[model samples]
Target chain A: MAESRRPLPRPTPETQHFWDGTRERELRLQRCDACSQVYFPPRPFCPACASRKVSVFAASGRGTLYSYVINHRAPPGSGFEPPYSIAVVELDEGPRMMTNIVGVPQTPEALQLDMPVEAVYEDFTDQITLPFFRPLEAS
Target chain B: MRPGSVAIVGAAETTELGRIPDQSQLQLHADAALNTLADAGLTPADVDGVATAGESPTGVAHYLGITPTWVDGTAVGGCSFMLHVRHAAAAINEGFCKTVLITHGESGRSRIGRGGFSRPAASLQGQFEAPFGTMGAPSTFTIPVLRYMKKYGVTEEQLAMVAVVQREWAARNPRASYRDPIDVDDVLSSDMIAYPFRKLMCCLVTDGGGALILTSAERARDFPQRPVYVIGTGESVETPMVSQMEDFTTSRAFRVSGRAAFEEAGIAHGDVDHLMIYDAFAHLPLYGLEDLGFVGRGEAADFVEERNTAEGGKLPLNTNGGGLSYMHSGMYGMYALQESVRQLRGTAPAQVKDARISIAHGVGGMFAASGTIVLSNEAR
Candidate 1:
């Protein structure tokens, strides 16, 4: 397979655990011990209470498609093909994440808002795994 | 202090509007500043305060030979200049400085000596928004439009009317980059950049700059040109990422900023003779109208479709064709302010007949930040 030229995420001291969880096919979020607030884009302190007493916990990878746009133009030097879907997936955990909707045609007709979705780990590099979302199949 | 306490005494754009390959970004700022200073019949030494964005305020001051006592470099986004005008007013009121000069220049199309702003891979947008292949403003900004359309039943035709009406205004502007007449069909037929947003719906990419000089209302008449009084100003910020916007249907920043400005100005919505909403995309005006309380929720798109914002409408918007049809040099708030000043001065090429009160509202990032300036020819 041609090496994916998509930009990869770099783990920082504050975001290492989140990436490590992604590497293990899990979506991790931080919950505040004081305010009981859950947040994404992990940080050491709770944005609500400014409390550092927070813990990272795995979340249910299931989410719903809040909104999205089908990009017809790929940015200059971006390796991704045109007509890819960029989406905002609202996790059942009450936080929204920016991700790509995969396993479906990148068309508005095919992509419906409020559709149930589940996270899929996409590896841009061997050491990096990013979470993408796809429509959950009916049982 | 009340907002009308300050006034804009001078305003000018770079000598040329579109595509100037010869000048660097800094040179564009200097060109605009020199033109504005000349319009006000003042030299750089007369400026006691300076503010700018996309470039350093210190650099602008040094280049313009302005040893300002107060300086602000609030690089919020396109709306940075609006916030600067507000901040300059506050500083002037508090006696921090007088005769403030706010400038903006961007070689967006030419990319000459433009600074880079690549976020660290671990940054919020980088780790969250960027990894999803969200491209430039065009792609990322589409997320809200899609949701807004679905919720409000705003048709593609209603959205296209924004560009169509703005182009009508641009046709009358000699300096507008694209003066050719276009309709909803033309906008719809244009190349699809992102789903629902065509090439015509997006703002032009051009190399240009604009500057404004503001002072207290007491010293306004000393300038060469008729001063445009700043009656009201407001600013607020949301999330930097478009996807993370609190509500895709409306911009919270626009509401907060617009409401504050309206309250401060003490002007009824109907009293606004002219309006300028920074239209980076066609949907922006819809959001601005609804959020600013000009029209009720979900009514802006239809209001626009009915020609409520066109040339002879109840409110004339984007008199300089806005960013959509006019020159958008990255930070577009300055250009919008320039139009407001022109309308109030009775000197705009496509002048609104007897236009007195003009509102210039701007969005910084992808609904991330906003600033509103309510201006009038008459001082309260």
Candidate 2:
């Protein structure tokens, strides 16, 4: 069996705008026009208030390392190398997203919880650009 | 909704467990279902309601040649079986069905006629979490423990203790996989799969299944085996993605589900004689302990380290060795419920003497959903 390439995101009608922003190196999020509450993994309606009145806007792309695990075993066909860090970053706008930590050693000593980090985009394909995080000081 | 209205008269696991290559996923369900029916001294024709996960209740009913009046195919995650039990009980009381058969089977290791665990690119997980190289449970389900450790001053040794103590229970069970005794040192020194989770802290991936039969309390006494009354039940969900959990230190779903069960049962924490908190990973029991109000915040680590949940301790937990030392087919909630039934029936390998009440609590996804069931030997 041959090694399979890593999976890429497929944008839906509701989430296409967020993926579109990523291709241009911008972090896009949805906020409710009625409640002014921000959310992620975009949808047409506000999850908080069930209000369909929402708008898309560019985000700061800044966050802090909330939690993560240094994976020692890579799944078959997943392009990740062993000992890579899979982290969840708490965005400044209050929604949290899962991403990878880059530009630093993927070890407990290097990736501290609550450490300030910023988004860096990787263009995997013409249609998909994944956003990873790294120590703010490293950038 | 009322305590003791419904009771479990039949409970059994597959004829064989741990690496069953001969049985496909549906066959495993059939094997367990047949075993359970035999345990209750009934036949497939007697079952009027069907509930299951992994395999559809429709498929189970058709394969077993039963024409069911009511069925539930709830597949939230590992804990789906717990929800099935709750739903089955309510369905029975409402006259929707008489005898309910809930079954679970998964060829997790053999991959025999089993579906792949992939999400569509357009799905929520595929769009956000999976794109970043998230592997299955080991990578994703094990993500929140780091924040939990930092917030509560939990140490790696304490986490290892969960595996160690459960192994003690497994050692006494003849059917447990990898029943040889293991200690905290052995656990800590074991291979690391994910940070904060060593090889022993992770659940074993084996192929097995279990089944249960429930009916109204009035009809339960006619069965051959001791009837375990369904005293209370609860179920809830939080988020599908681990990153979206309200707080990493706790499981909001577990809290909500457990409280509802306890309230419905009208029992205090002290009334529980045995407990089974789904241990898909080591951190789960820690979160379960606090979230279920068995311990205060930041106290579960010390509570387990102090031997409160170990053998001859205040609360006997995971007495069947749990998913860690016991058998963990992808969905482990069935096995958890089985152990609760065994403990309450006084037939468990590591049975607590004179055990009366047992609570089986399970988390479905990565803290995404939860279901809790309280069982007792006495009707009251």
Candidate 3:
């Protein structure tokens, strides 16, 4: 039963490195060497400029909770429970990522937008660990 | 642009619209494809390319008994079908195939193959929003509409104004399913499906099928119809994840695509005669109006209030009743383009009187991808 839970998107050639980094418990951003723009969707080249000079870089893995929604439906093969916080995290390195705000009470008031959050990796297997986020209290 | 203009010469549908019989998804697709070919005065043998949507094990090309040079089953969102027109046009322009048929069949009314594509959420989207009960298209779109209403200070009356006006337009359209004219009060009072969006604002899913036969403008001369030239098109994607979208009040994708389409067509906004924006919900037109640059930002409600967007107004829109009242075959994008073509032909049941220029706009994937097409009397 545990073996059936597969991530919805099996990363393709363009995004395999990004997913691999996720599994390795490191947040990697595809940074364009030509323009210094970090891309969330790892691509063949820089979207800002048509330059193919782009490389993956490990980010600080700290970010702010940008926005989120709580999904109730049980998607096929997705073992997540209802009422979990799915969100966009604005990374410290400036790239916004689609992720979940985990280990926090799920409510609009509790899950405030722009709340400071940091990434925590949950290793499921040797090749797959999801990067979930938690609220980082402002010091 | 090079001279390879894909003209939609034929269009047909099998809208078991009001009360669709229990036909399989494949049967609906086959019927629509055959009907479209007959309408175009051709047969399945004459077609070389087939583009389709819906969960049918039999691929469209194999079902149609012809081999296509290109097969695009990109299931991005409901509006992905409109995106296919642009893809088909480019393919036709590139001399890949001559006759391209784009089609869609869905038993949404019956929920065939329910949860067919609801696989695991990956690519960080699952990590963030998928767990939080922030689910599905209607609910995802609802939050943004709420934000639009909130940020713009749009009242419920103004939001309902879209439905009142749409009902009016739908009344004239024989193809429209819901003919009962609704007022602002009716829209406001209707059962709230999601906050800010009432049952009236949401599109009624109907079991329907739509088919389009696209051929070069040069090939259009031989057909028994006026050639609606594919002038200019632009499609853009913002984010597949709803939570990642930058703004809820407006669509960034539409803004991007609108500029590109306007530039490609070399036409000004004021020059547009007919507008066919996807009205999956009332707020869609609101978002579309703002991002399409028709009205000032956050003023789409006022734009509708001023009666600038209704039929017989300065800007006549959704002449074939739109998806709100018309049969929505899951993907409303193809329907929008088909209606635009019908308007240009002066043959639509709800024709926009001599529509020389028509804009076919589609909003898809929780406002992720927007595609715009500017079809004129001829390529200017």
TM-scores of all predicted structures? 0.97, 0.98, 0.78
What lDDT tens digits, residue by residue, belong to model 1 across residues B117-162? 6867777888788877888888887788878888999999888999
Counting clashing residue pairs in each candidate, in order, gives 0, 0, 20
User: TM-score: which is higher, 1 or 3?
Assistant: 1
Ranking by DockQ: 2, 1, 3
Q: iRMSD per model? A: 1.1, 0.8, 5.1
Which one wins on DockQ?
2
The list of candidate 3 runs beyond 4 A from truth reads A1-139, B1-4, B18-21, B55-58, B113-115, B121-123
Q: What is candidate 2's DockQ?
A: 0.84
Model 3 TM-score on chain A: 0.85
Off by over 4 Å in 1: A75-77
**Fnat, 2 decimals, each candidate:** 0.79, 0.88, 0.18
Residue lDDT tens for model 3, B1-380: 33226688888787455446577667677777887888899988888777765643247777778777776675667777677777888888888889988887777777653335463555444544443344566656655554566567888799788878877888887778988888888888887554556778778788778788888887888998777887878889897766657776677899998888888777888888999899888778888878888888888888888888776688888777777887676678877887888888888886676678899999887887888888876643
DockQ for each of the predicted structures, in order? 0.78, 0.84, 0.17
Over all chains combined, what TM-score does candidate 3 have?
0.78
